[model samples]
Target: MTRLVVLSLCIGMVSAASVMSAASAAGPAPSGTAGMLFNHEHLNNGSPGWNETGVRLNYTLAPRHAFELAVARTERFDLRDRQLSALYVAPLSRELTGSLEANASSTHRVLARNAFGTTLQYEFAPAWLVHGGVKTTRYDTVRVNQALLMLEHYFSNFSWAVAWRPAHAFGTNANSAEVRASYYYGDKNTIGVILAGGKEAANIGNAVTLTDLRSAAVVGRHWLNREWALNYGIGSTRQGDFYVRNGMTLGVQYAF
Candidate 1:
């Protein structure tokens, strides 16, 4: 179903942690900096394929303060949908940071009508961080709410993270967990692997269903120069009693 497709997209993009971790790995960009990114992804489940194209713009207003806007178009099951999203991140303190994100889709037939999320991260010790977040998503026929907690550690050029998420939807509850490990290399370059498994609720043919899912992915970013970078990901997912999906993503970023 569409919920499974959304999960695939999350794996292909490596989730929000990818963005936050990459920023930590590369350190902060100068204030007044701006960047643009273009991304394309393709996914198949042994039948008709799904594709998504997206663009994102990011601007840094000051140290530890930034904003992002993005738009995406997706084609799946012979239907097309468009979504718009925005995010703001700021420092609550020297050791605490917070972010808020909201998104909406033009069509709710296959995507969520709207969603909002907020996260707070704190560094309690050198090279160690903890994050907590909550999100709510409204679909055409159902509303899902989720809470997440994550812990991360950095040493030398390597970083490791683990997260747990609990979700409620359609009067049912489910849980999932994920782990990621990344290595930083060169200037603003990183490579990482992610593994996740869990149960989730999905909308299927007018009925809400709870299903099991598992996914794995490898993602990376490489700087071609001071102003250009390439991002790539490849992954696969298994949706219980449904389908197996394999996908790849490629993107480019430019900064000024």
Candidate 2:
């Protein structure tokens, strides 16, 4: 599933790292730097429904350098019609860091889900980061290749994150874990309180399809100007035969 379509666009941007969280004074930009982000998701995993669109590009290849590219498209309203994901990110260092990325995907009956797999990343601080990869998939799977780890923290108003994925036949699993608490009085408003649960299993070579799931999510953010910003979130996923009633995301970002 193209690594689940880049992990479902990383669950709608993962709070955009708290909107870049201040600290912006590393001058020299204007040699062609740009920013754009748009995301939409409305999934009703009952019978036939899913409409997803994602577009991202943040560019600057100079002073301190930068580059990111993401493309996603999903349309399934009558079953069978999918062109999943594409991504590329590069920014080697400015502090303990590293990067390398690639992914080409399609799978959810649209077929063809394997052709690219190359990911290696490392980051030390600023909420630390790490990823080790190799993904290739098909039916009757019993370990195409897998090893993934993700951890995130933004403490203060409270935050927590977790991910441990092993895909052979769902041997090692815990694909998600999140705990959150938030509050921001005014001027860049934010009010939140959320609790999440996780577990996902996909047995290789589908016995048709096998998956166990769990979920819970609620988040919100607002700042009408200074380059535009508004975010809304809702979540629910209880899988047995797949069911996620309400999940939403709307975002905009620009700062150059």
Candidate 3:
């Protein structure tokens, strides 16, 4: 569910990229709506180490729809079990928009959980975006379904977004929820922070467990040419005192 909602926002960012291009253009700038990037990172904060290099493509299908495809393989993560996703952006009105998406995987490793999901979005106001949806687990015994609601505002080159949701971790009726938000700043450089707390049920034992996570990220981008660019971000995740991981990514992209 979080994956889909974020993709919707990414779609919006792609559309806004075009709009920003228009706003910056003296005349008609080349109307190219697709941007592709190749990203790499050697990052490890607390969990299994991850060194990844992958490519991602983001583009528009129409004035109201967008699509994205990404494939990345870590040292331990399977290359065959990659990531691919799509989104349908709907505009309820000029300033209001909505979207739907599917985030799926080709294989479910031990590390894989909630590998597939569906999402929906509603933009009730210009300063706020609302969303709700659900997702389920892809493997055995464990059945986790999640629903979320989010609100966000965009101002100039920066924006803030926050959301809360109920997550049911199958095998029991107990449900838990979490709230998280991130803020970005600058024309291209950005920083973000997230705070989340929730609970979940164990699939095998049916025991309930509290889930709390904190995250912070720093990103930088540099455009070398009209069709070439670079992007990098570093972030850390704290999942209680038991599990923690730090991740970093860098990519060079060429768009046609």
**What are the Cα lDDT values of the candidates?**
0.69, 0.42, 0.43
Where model 2 places Cα greater than 4 Å from the true spot, the runs are 1-58, 62-99, 102-226, 229-238
- Alpha-carbon deviation at 63 in model 3, angstroms: 3.8
Question: How would you encode candidate 1's per-residue C-alpha lDDT over 63-119 as one tens digit per residue?
Answer: 456777888887655667899988888878887788888999988556678989888
Minimum summed lDDT over a 10-residue window in model 2 is located at 1-10
TM-score rank order = 1, 3, 2
- Mark the regions of model 3 whose C-alpha exceeds 4 Å error after superposition: 1-48, 75-81, 92-96, 111-114, 172-191, 197-211
Question: How many clashes does each candidate structure show, in the order listed?
Answer: 0, 2, 4
lDDT of 2 by residue, 1-256 (tens): 0000011222311322221221111344333312333334355544544555555555545432344565556544444433433333344555422233343445554323433444444445654444445554543343344344555444444434454545444454334444444555444456554554444343212232335555556666565665555556666655555455455555554544
For every candidate in turn, the CA RMSD to the true structure comes to 5.3, 17.6, 6.9
Candidate 1: segments with Cα more than 4 A from true spot: 1-9, 12-18, 21-45, 203-208
